[model samples]
Target: MICLNSLGKRIAYLRKRSNLTQRQLMNILDFENLSRYENDERKPNIDIIVKLSKHFKISTDWILTGQEHKSYRNFQHKIELDDNEKNFIKLFDQLTEFEKGQIIGRMEQLIEMH
Candidate 1:
């Protein structure tokens, strides 16, 4: 029986839950090493781990270990956002209250102009 402790199992589980095929994930990751990772033939390096974690919006700790984190557990429906959209949201969220208001005001102005 495969246990959650196995990195391969965790990855495979996530991939399936996300409703993605190995080929789809491979295309998205742009890496051919996924097969090895899923097979437990090899472990991903820190950089690869970080990339996967960010891509999946999951904690590295949870990925490396079997522990279910609240963040991962409460994961909502999959919403695919490209890098630009993700970056924009991240930057926007980091803005101060006044800054955010200013940005929203600008956005509203732009929308009105359209």
Candidate 2:
């Protein structure tokens, strides 16, 4: 059950948290529809929802209702997910370019060892 207000807030939060401008969210000529979806003036159709969920690799239920799938959450949260995975990724994405490079270098080392 998607309440329009909550849904809109969720969408806006996710978009901003993901560091995307509304224009970057959809390829449509007019950016108003995506704005409307974030503003609670409109709801995206099921197709749009499916596309977004797949692209984000997020649970549709979480998008609609803010409840994540349990297993993935558990696996990702051993470091203790106070917020959600999206928020964690968002923070990581916002890191400085140099910081990201350093992190990626360390990650590569970890990957090569495994």
Candidate 3:
């Protein structure tokens, strides 16, 4: 079974390490929502987990299990992005830092609605 307390601690740790307050994390979650997660009063759904993983640049496995899957670690270097993904990255790279953040915030809002 997953340990909610440990997962909460990890989330808090990542936030602090990134120098982000719970309010600053509103790009991914509301302040109260993030506080509840960090307090272990709630468990985020899979969509939220994926968003958090992308925001933190960590694997979902690491977020949930605190460890990388051995197979993933072994084959990660061989993985390749598809052409559409490559094009998306090219476009994203052209944005200013503030515009990039806005894009991420919009994506997070879209994800949260579903």
Per-residue alpha-carbon lDDT of candidate 1 for residues 1-114, written as tens digits (9 for 90 to 100): 656778887888888879999889889876777878989999988766766777798878888997766765556345678999989999986776579889999999999998
Q: lDDT per model, in order?
A: 0.81, 0.74, 0.81
Instruction: Give me the displacement of residue 59 in model 3, in angstroms.
Output: 0.1
| Stretch of 10 with least lDDT, candidate 2 | 24-33
**Runs with alpha carbons beyond 4 Å of true place in candidate 3:** 1-5, 28-32, 81-85, 88-114
- lDDT computed for candidate 3: 0.81
Model 1: residue 7 alpha-carbon error in angstroms: 0.8
Give candidate 2's root-mean-square deviation (CA, Å).
9.9
User: How accurate locally is residue 56 in candidate 1, as Cα lDDT from 0 to 100?
Assistant: 90
Please identify which of the two predictions, 1 or 2, would achieve the higher lDDT against the true structure: 1
Kindly list the per-residue Cα lDDT of model 2 for residues 1-114, writing each as its tens digit: 534347777877777777888888775322358889888789888667765676667778777887877886887667655568768678876686578779889999999999
Model 3 RMSD in Å is 9.2
